[model samples]
Target: MAASSSRSFAEVQRRVSGVHRGTDPEQQLRFYDGWAPEYEQDVTILHYQAPRLAASCLASAIQGPLADALVLDVACGTGLVAQELQAKGFCRFHGLDGSQGMLESARRKGLYQELKQCVLGQEALPASSGFYDAVLIVGALSEGQVPTSVVPELLRVAKPGGFLCLTTRSNRSNLRYKSQMQQLLDDLEQRGLWEKVKVQEVERWERATSEQEAMEGSDYISGVVYLYRKAQTVGF
Candidate 1:
């Protein structure tokens, strides 16, 4: 599929809405496969900033040398997260996404040292435990995408004192899922798995794409970026 130079908001929203309508991971994968060519363009049209926001938080929270750190980019569609981190001096990255087409697009950027295919929430992350200096998942932790259960898996892959950064929209549609995700994050902190590092909430996450949001007269919706540090000693 060739990329289109011009993409209208209606077309972009329709594509986004189509992906959201997918009922299962396989279906979503198919949607993303077809969407890979224009994914960047569409998100650009939306002024999507989750990748940038999550990368900023991760960069700020990391403790050691950025170049040497092995960062795991989960649900890393088209290498957007890596692009942002690369701009911040982070060099090493391993990416994982379910869509082969999406991975192919990411591969062209030459940002990731490794790229694997895994359906998040349905499959275990294909990486060694306690290896990465930082792990991140952005724009994929909402109601229909990755479940909160995979958060522990993110922590499991990070080295002690490493950081795990995540982002989710806080718009009206995602409030319930966000609440559940936050509860799990809080529970993990209490369980000695990780400690809270930062929670940055932005009012202009992206231009509103849904009709309901437009009807409400809001130009942009809200979102959040969460950063956590893995404990030095984690028990299970």
Candidate 2:
């Protein structure tokens, strides 16, 4: 799909809705693989802000030299999060995504030291324990996307005291999923797996895509960015 300044909301909504209709991980991967080329453009059309917001949340929580931080970007998706982190002075990045096409698109940017394909929830993250200074997964934790169970893998990959940043939509459509995910995060924190650093709720996460939201006169969807630091020692 070619870039079009004149692309309407209907087109963007249609594409987004198509991906949502995917019944299984394979179907979702196929949809994303085919959309990879146009993914950035479509998100740009939606004014997607989770990548930037999550990156910023992680960057602020990082303690040492930004350039030395080995960041693992989960569901990297065309390197949008890496791009935002790079703008903040972080250098090394390792990206992972389920779609080969999406990984290829990220590779073209030459921002990552490594890139791999791993379908979230289905496979273990191909990263060593306690290896990353920071790990982030943006735009992947929402309803019908990655499940909250994957949070453990994210925690496993981060160094003790390293940050883990995640984002999810807080709009009406995602409210139940968000609540469940939030419970998991809170439980982890209670168990000393990690501690909360910041949690920000933004009213304008992206342009509203559903007709129900439009009917409700909402122009943008809400989202939350969650930042947490891995515990240095187990409390359990």
Candidate 3:
């Protein structure tokens, strides 16, 4: 029993290390393309918990209904959360990510009215300013995945009063990443870029029913969620 437990802990640590190492845009795109098909399946059996929890936390942050609203799913990956939003009644939807291969899988879902390839951190938003009513970013905030610099750009494209919701793995104990994200949010708030509306951390757990599922789910290291809202214009 002791030997088995030690092996399990080591496997979990290895997977966590891989995610913490981060990846460049090109590498991320390539990785996602190769990972798209297996990604959803793996998430469904083992990885579904985080995205579902994050999306639920996001939904709770909004104040009003989103029936007629236009939403942007940044780094949408395979549109997992976008599909969830749509099913909940959001009509107009757009999904943007750097991985064409991932987008290919998202396109098949027939959810987004628009789907574009965007390299996070460097790629300019394809839409015009104030075009979306809300922007939902799930599993995007990280060290190498998305630079802190992108927060301002995200605020720029959202309409005043619109939502700019995002989730980042909780790094409260990791001062470096925590300070990086806090500073980014502070800069945006100081510039009147967006209002600090809601910020919360959620814990996530994964359980596996099969050996294959257990192997894939074993990779998740730390899981937490954060959200923010873009301030509405003063006087309407």
Candidate 4:
């Protein structure tokens, strides 16, 4: 990669990260809603793969009827995960996102059966307990996004023996947040809420890299995805 290209990518990363620099959820919503129009392009530029990689990982381990399985897609931005999962044979879907703009984009795809707007970590998840056959979230478990406290909520919404998959970036900026989330996951498992199924660290997860690692041709990001199954009986 040329020095000029590296510099250009770094600038893009800076602007993107700046949009969600604060803890104010409303401001972040506005930024994300406005970014909906160009969200795919920007993620493409960054080589985002949480959607596809997570879909593939879950799809491979899926059981029962694929065409009839109910899925709750948390933070279903632009329905990218829906698209990927649709390709893998899942039909029913419910999408949840905080950004109405992003929900509109996802709605246009005609993939989800329902779409709801809820600010994660701040608001209660608008789903019944043990309702979804698969409850999955991606790209929203990192810094400046959802908090680690929602781990139990995600598990609560998933049916007993159902799967819950989530992904988080494994980069310098998100390492601390990742640690907190991991501890929550472990705590949930200990309490017999869920059981760990699989964990994968995907290399070259995305491109365009990060501002902290800006260098010529150094544009591949890495992330980890975790899969778990809700316990059939809590505290049993």
Candidate 5:
């Protein structure tokens, strides 16, 4: 193993973990803006797989031609998820995020046809109900980021018969958040909002070999990708 590679990975992991521990919006946005230039590089070092996992899951479940579908990617930092989806035959993409720096980097990739700025959970989403054929929000459904309440907004943007995909980490620190998210999904299902399409529990979500995270019994973190199909006859 290279010494320089290991040192660089550790530094990125520490910063990534630190970003999740705070509840300050401005501070988090500033941190991401500063980290935007090297963000893709750092996540690649972490072996982040949520974007790939989410795209694969959504692609397999969609019934129509992916190229004809319009996708809305929320919290689309650097267009990673859109890039993954585009590889799976999805062509049209619209993205939203809170960071201008990150969106600028994403624009250079040419994945999204439109990119808008919105502070999720606080600001109203700038989309009509049932507008998109597919709605995706990867890597932003965590506790210190977008609140669990935003899940409904994700559901709202999708067409009545469209798909909704979301991903989140499942580490020791996120136990309560995960539980709450699960409960919300269950309640929405019971209320006839959307039915589950698939739920994939990912074991190798990322490589965070830091001593603090390793105490969870492994050098890696786990995550889950949840896919749902909205009801065609009713809105919930």
Candidate 6:
């Protein structure tokens, strides 16, 4: 694993654990609620354009109108991608997240058919196994309050032969953190749970506005998108 000046994996792990320690969902909700108004602004200032690119990538990869498919959007922060999906005619959209503020923002968009408030790692999904035809997770694999255990849970809820699409920062940027994501993919493949369908690196570029001259610097970030298809059957 390559070294990163960014937060250490252990440090991120500790933070995630601490966020859930209080056992009060409202505490988590308040944190995201505080972040909602500025969330998009902060990400844009930071050049976090992966979500839009990931949404486009997923929109192109899906076989048909997502309207016909039951879809789940995990950790759907501000419903950016969910809004995109809905715009593309996907009607049965279900969004799940731990932050009440995020869900509030999502609800305001009127994109989701159903919204559930629960932590991704701890909350059990309301659906049965193999219930959804597609699952889209964009920009949720990074540190900062994301649960590492949610990966397997995603696969567990997806139906056989369903599609699971994920996007995250590239391995080149942070190998240790990227390795954690790779491990999730590898484990799913090894268990005959999913088959690799597409993998690509996406680059996003942003230019500073006149008002934000001081923020002009390196204007691009590298990210990766991985799309996998769950197998029709798994052998024990």
My TM-score estimates for the predictions, one after another, are 0.95, 0.94, 0.78, 0.91, 0.94, 0.76
Query: What lDDT score belongs to each candidate, Candidate 1 first?
Result: 0.88, 0.87, 0.67, 0.83, 0.85, 0.68
What tens-digit string does per-residue lDDT give for candidate 5 at 26-131?
7777777887888887888888899989999999988879999999999998899998998899999999998888899889889899999888888778998989
Query: Where is model 2 poorest over a 10-residue stretch in terms of lDDT?
Result: 1-10
Task: State the lDDT of candidate 6 residue by residue for 1-236, as single tens digits.
Answer: 01123444344333333332333445666766777765655554455565566566666777876678888998888888776666666678899887777888788888788888766666776667878888878776654445557777777778888888887664233445668878979987987789998887765522222222222243444568888888898431
lDDT of 4 by residue, 142-229 (tens): 7888777777888888888889999998776777888998998998888778899999998787763455744345567678999999
Query: Judged by lDDT, which candidate is best?
Result: 1
Report the lDDT tens digits of candidate 2 across residue range 44-118.
Answer: 889888988887888788877899999999999889999999999999999999999899999999999999999
Model 3 weakest 10-residue run by lDDT? 1-10
Indicate the residue-level lDDT of 196 in model 1: 93
lDDT of 1 by residue, 1-236 (tens): 12345989999888887755527888888888999999998988898889988888888777668898899999998999999999999999999999999999999999899999999998788987899899999998987888888998999889988899999888777788999999999999988889998999998898888866542557898899999999999853
What is the lDDT, from 0 to 100, of the residue 93 in candidate 3?
83
**Cα RMSDs of all predictions?**
2.2, 2.3, 6.9, 4.2, 2.9, 8.5
- Model 2 misplaced stretches (Cα beyond 4 Å): 1-6, 214-217
What is the model-wide C-alpha lDDT for candidate 4? 0.83
* Model 1's TM-score against the true structure: 0.95
Task: Flag regions of model 5 displaced more than 4 Å.
Answer: 1-7, 215-217
State the displacement of the C-alpha of residue 126, model 3, in Å, after optimal TM-score superposition. Answer: 0.9
Candidate structures ordered by TM-score, highest first? 1, 2, 5, 4, 3, 6
Instruction: Look at candidate 2 and give me any clashing residue pairs.
Output: none
Model 3: per-residue lDDT, tens digit, 69-164?
888888888888777776566767899989898899889889899999988788778888777778877776766677777776777778788777
